[model samples]
Target: MAKLHIAMYPWYSFGHMIPYVHLANELAARGHRISIFVSKKAHSKLQSHNLHPHLITFITITIPKVDGLPEGTETGHDVPMELNHLLCDAMLLTRQQVEEILTADKPNFVFHDLAFWIPQVTKKLGIKSVCFLVISATCMASGIKPFREVTDDKPLTEEELTTPPPGYPSATVVLTLDEIMSLLGASDFSGMTKLHEGFTTSMSDCDVLAIRSCTELEGKFCDYIQAHYKKPLLLTGHVLPEESESKLEQRWADWLQGFEPGSVLYCAFGSQYVLEKDQFQELVLGFELTGLPFFIALKPPVGCTNIEEALPEGLEERVKGRGVVHGGWVQQTLFLSHPSVGCFVSHCGFGSMWESLVSDKQIVLVPHLGDQIINTRLLSTDLKVAVEVKREKNRWFSKESLNEAIKSVMDKDSEVAILLKKNHLELREKLIKPGFSSGYVDRFVQSLEELAN
Candidate 1:
């Protein structure tokens, strides 16, 4: 066997980019060469992690300015929801720079995130390409089935929208009307259509499909995807970084130290989700009602400068000593792994889910958008390791609902709490034990090597 040179490109979101970095580092540790293509902004974040210099190299590419996009918007996290489509459109412009790198480097294989056009470029250059899915296997399987089988442009009927996609009989995950409307109404329909087409073409044309999940957790969904796509699929496990000792900020450390062991609730929506004023207030009131110590990191809604302005007046003072609210970055892993943290109230992004799972924390899900809704279903319905907040008719949850859900998870005698605790412990044992994630990465790299040869 010979060492292989690989090229990797991920979508401009941190959720997408960080997982790819985990995979690249794993491959590099196994003595392979990996070149990562990222924007200057993303490259700076990657460099901050201080990745292995010898085996992994990052190439910076300029994101071409689109007319409607804000100046210097290079990634999904930097742009607003309405302008996300323009970001996607801007990525297409990078094809020339990518082509130049491909021509110069001639790596054995290219691993790309859902930028559908990458496969076409690989095909033209006669390089093997793999489609790396950064989402759950259920979301990928469900999302692609319609694009692959349904040709009609007609909108889905109420019944059609709520049912599981064909061929996934065991899957309990289905899109609600609210979820469907959010997707259709959020951005340019044409852009979304193209993105769907990209998924189909990328899966149909790629040499392999790699997902950031394990058979232990999503075996059934993975099997369904393999049968449906009729392509070799690789499970990349969680591709999470190994837990290590790191310095925590003294202010947060001291605050967390004051709480009883495993008694604090940690709340954070990922980088992309912004809370409207009403939602923010409800969450604050809900957490305050729990009467438990909590730490929250939130992104203010558009035009709001900080969390204080977005929160209800006197809310912070009312919850004093019981809650700590920070608007900007908080080291999530440190907080999740802390001795005082018990439950994670999250947006249910895959990255956050992985972190919560490995940290052995009970999850209280408040899914806001996109695949998160599916993730919430999977976590609560399929896995039974978390409980989702009750939503009302309009899909909005009341503060009472949030408070009740948190109490249900935190109550030691409750069946939901006991079951979640049991499962969380089992999952943590599986994830943190040596070689659990690495085994999957090893097999994935071997499969890629075999394909390259």
Candidate 2:
């Protein structure tokens, strides 16, 4: 296949951009020219991940300020979920920037997510637009359909969302009522279509549809998408993070080394999603109850300036030697590979889900809307590679539920522990098999070439 130039513009959040860069690196490594649209600050953080800098380039785009958005907000990470639509508004305003770049560069393809109107832009320019989703295919399947099929303005209701859409894969588990509610309310930003409609429009408008996932893991979901939408689809595998020459920070390495191998728990939610103070304390209290050495790299609770202020009154002192809580980012990939880190307690974002899947650790997921689809799939009886913390009717979990979920995987003698560990290890081995991810990339590139042809 001839070398192609692919321009990617993922959502402004760090989680979304980082995964795009991972895929960009894979494509660049395959001798393709790649250009990524990013804000200067986001590019600053992503610079180190550009392994093939000679082939990959960054195109700057401006984020227009919306009324509710803070003055300097260039990414969704800077704001609470309630204000994300404002970010989306800002993303839409970059249409001129995107079109000018596309007009100037005349790339073979432009890959996008979050820009639901991207198809409208590419169609006019006669560029092949790929809606390469950063979210799971399952999420796409249930929430989206052909944009032309919708004849009414009514949004998908909670009841409809809780069950798989017609022609969806026969997965035994569907979204819980709470998750469905979260989804319905997530995009409450005025002047925007509902989240489900947005996804439907995105997939419907694209020339080629691709997911940051693999057939081995989500083949049925991918099939459902291709058949349902009648659009050519591609999978980029998990686009696993490239191995880093950087090591874990010295302080964290020393602390983790003191624990027995596979004994400590590492917990992190991605950059977004701040817990309420009560919930943050509940989460820490749960970690404390586990009595296992743990490191928590999460944002401070809402209403607090930092993690230190949000820590429960005595949590630090009680877990003094065994626990540390930090608010800022850390080397998540390197920490996951550490020998002493035995288990992963994740907020279950797509990137984290893939990271956890590729690790040897026991998996425990606490799903927010961001990953409810994939998280449910992993914990379903069909796969059973991980366990989920039980939540109350209001979708809140007690410290005990959190504690037990961790300890369930920690206890070697328990039947559930044995099953989870066995299944997780076997699956991880399969996913990381030599060429598993790269093979997907190869086929994905072929699909792109076919589209261009």
* Top candidate, metric lDDT: 1
State the displacement of the C-alpha of residue 365, model 2, in Å, after optimal TM-score superposition.
1.0
Q: State residue 316's C-alpha deviation in candidate 1, in Å.
A: 2.8
State each model's CA lDDT, in order: 0.83, 0.82
Candidate 1 residue 159 C-alpha distance from true site, Å: 4.2
RMSD of each: 2.3, 2.7
The C-alpha local distance difference test score for the whole of candidate 2 amounts to: 0.82
The number of the candidate with the highest TM-score is 1
lDDT of 1 by residue, 242-349 (tens): 765677889999989998998999999997788777878888888988998998898886668987778778977888887988898988999988889999999998
Worst 10 residues of 2 by lDDT: 184-193
Provide the TM-score for each candidate, comma-separated.
0.93, 0.92
